[model samples]
Every structure is written in structure tokens, then in C-alpha cells.
Target: MKLLLVEDDSDYAATLSRALEAMGHDVVVARDGVAAIEFNDRDQFDAIILDRMLPQMDGTTLVERLRERGQTLPVLMLSALGQSIDKVDGLKAGADDYVVKPTSVGEIDARLHALVRARGWKGEGATTLRAGAILVNPGKHRAWYGDDALDLSNLEFKLLAELTRHAGSFVTRTMLLERVWGYDFEPATNIIEVQIRALRRKLTASGSPDPIVTKRGVGYMLEA
Candidate 1:
């Protein structure tokens, strides 16, 4: 994921950037709220880690401005002010999530991921999807492989629905993480592979040919 880190403290920004980069995200630093808004205008990013207080525009004001301009990107506001009123102000101004200062970096990462997940399928407008032998009805929370009804867990259903949308195109691990789990980067676990194996088993349980194709060093594609 590409992230915008808005922090006036150069040292804190550097450390946070390094940590997020190590998590497989691309980080762009904006030292002030005005600069952050400028960066937003120039390019798209997955999310923003914004500081509550800054030189020019404060984080809450920045969030309000962004919302006024119809920007729906997720934002995580960090503040030394841990008062309930401070957090309420951030959310009312349209920050997706707020964290008090000195919070664990892992907690911050988790909150960012949660925010993205909450908005995951908003832009896609996905409905029932089909690819060759597979059919997935997201609204119905159901799927079928050529008349063989599939009983899938929530995760499996989401994974299959994503693959069915692409049909013949390769869906990379990173893409699956973002779309299915709202994760911006590949996790340390073999979650994608594990889900793929489960989905394959169900798709082939009725003696149909395996429709999922795996490419070495690439990704997975569902045959059409």
C-alpha cells in the first residue's frame, strides 16, 4: 500500500516511515497539513497517517477539508491529546480512526487495516459474479460450482468472489490481501495459499476439473 505520513517531527516521521516500509508499504512524508493536502492532490494513496497538531493546518481541520472536497480515503490521526473530546473531534471532522500518542505501532497498523476493510468494496459495486464453471452471489452469500452448491466459510467466500470477478486474469497475492482481507501487504502467514487450497478442494469435490491456475512467482487465475 502507498501511505502518506503527515508529521512535522522529522525524526518521528522517519522512524514511522521505516517501520511501515518494512511492512511492505510505500511511504511518502508530508511535514505539514498543507503539504499533505498538496500531496493528496498530486497522487492517490491507500491511506494517511496524520498528526493531530501541525504548523499550518491541524489534522482535524485537514480532515474536514478533505471531506468537504469529497475525499473518502481512510485516515488515522495520531495525537498526544488522549482526551475523549480530542478523539471525538477527529472523528466528527472525518478522520476514520484516532489513536493517542505513544500507542503501539502494531495497534496503529491494525487500526489502519480495519479502516480500509470497512470501505473495501464500496468502489467496486460488486454483485453476483461468474467465471466459467464458478458462480458467486455476494449479496446472497452463496456460491455454486456447476450445480454443486458450495458450503464455504466467510473468508473462502470472499476469496472466491474476488477470483471470479477477474476470471482469466491473474490475481496477485498482494491484490488478494487488499481486496479480501483489507490488508495492504502480504502477511507473514500463508493465508492466501491456505484459502486457495480449501477453495480448490470444494470446486473439485463434484469431479469438475480444477479451474484455478497458479503461476510460479506470479499469482492465481480462475479459468473461464
Candidate 2:
């Protein structure tokens, strides 16, 4: 995986960069929070490793700013401060995973995998979600459209949840495979198209116009 490692400590950054490289990850080292933010804008990375404390902008503030700008890449916050409250604060600021400093490479790698895997699984903690005329209760796996309850199966619910999460943006078939089906490898079947058709049928059963848009040769998008 390609990663952005942000740290003010040059020696530590070098050491960590080497270790990460040895582990087969491409690492870009950024010296401080300002550099980290700039690097993020200039490139795309699978994940970001941000130091909790940095010169100029702190880690938490940087992540919050990134989120405000609609940067959705997974972030793994690294900090020497290991308090529960500190971890909570980092997560609330949009860091996907928070780990105390002095962690093993194995742990960091594992957490990175977990963060990416959990990206579109909103059913974990989200109670309710709204996208245009659609309302979803993820906990109960129930949905509604303008007073009409939607009847959805397990895969259908997951698909709808992912589309609604990125309501105004295009959700590619590759994205659906990974996020909804949790498949790392693309399958040789048309399962996504099949399921999408099934979902559209149920969603429009009440005479509601189809909310999903298919961009040919591209992907799908949900209109809000």
C-alpha cells in the first residue's frame, strides 16, 4: 500500500519509513503537519500516518481540516499520548484509527487493514441515515421512502447504505464490490448489476422515480 507518514522527528521518520518500505509499502515522509497537508493535496495515498503533535497545525486539527475539504482517505493517528480521551478526540476529528506511539509495525499494519475494511460499513454504529427521499435505519436494516417502508434483503441493504453514504457522488462498481460485498478481488460475475436491479425494483415499487443513476462505463450514483 502507498502511505503518507507525517512526523516532525526526522530520525524517527527515516526509521519508520525504512521499516514500512521493508514491509512492501511505499512510504512518503512529511516533516510536519504543514508538509503533511500539502503532500496530501498533491497525491493520493491508501492511508495516512499522522503524528498527534506537530509543528504549526496539530494532527487533530489537520485531520479535521482534511475532512472539511471532503478528503476521505483512511487516517491512522499516531501519538505518544495513549489516554482513552485522547484516542476518542482523534477519532472524533476524523482519524479512522488512533494508536499510541511505540507500537509495533505488525499492529500498525493490522490497524491500517482494519480501517480500510471498515470504510463503508456504516451499519456498525450509525443509527439512521437520510439521502433525498430515502431514510434508512441501519441498525434494524430498515428503510423508507416518503412514508412507504422499503423491503430489502441483506445485500440490498448494504448496497443502499453505501450509495446513500456518498449520496451525491458516483459509486463505482469496483467500490461496490469492496465496500458492500467486502470482496477484495473482483468476481467474474454480474452480481452488482443484478443486485442493483433488484434494489431499484423495490425502491420504485411505490411509484417513486428511480434514485440511482448509472454512468455507463463508469459506475452508479445516488441522487439526493
Best by TM-score: 1
Give the CA lDDT, 0 to 100, for residue 131 in model 1: 74
- Candidate 1 ranges with C-alpha deviation above 4 Å: 121-224
Give the local distance difference test score of model 1.
Answer: 0.84
What would the per-residue lDDT of candidate 2 be over residues 133-168, giving only the tens digit for each residue?
676667667777655778789999999999988888
TM-score against truth, every candidate: 0.54, 0.54
Residue-level lDDT of model 1, residues 45-162, one tens digit each, is: 7789999999899999998876654456789999999999999999999998999888877888889889889978232124446676466678778787754679999999999999
- Tell me which residue pairs clash in candidate 2: none
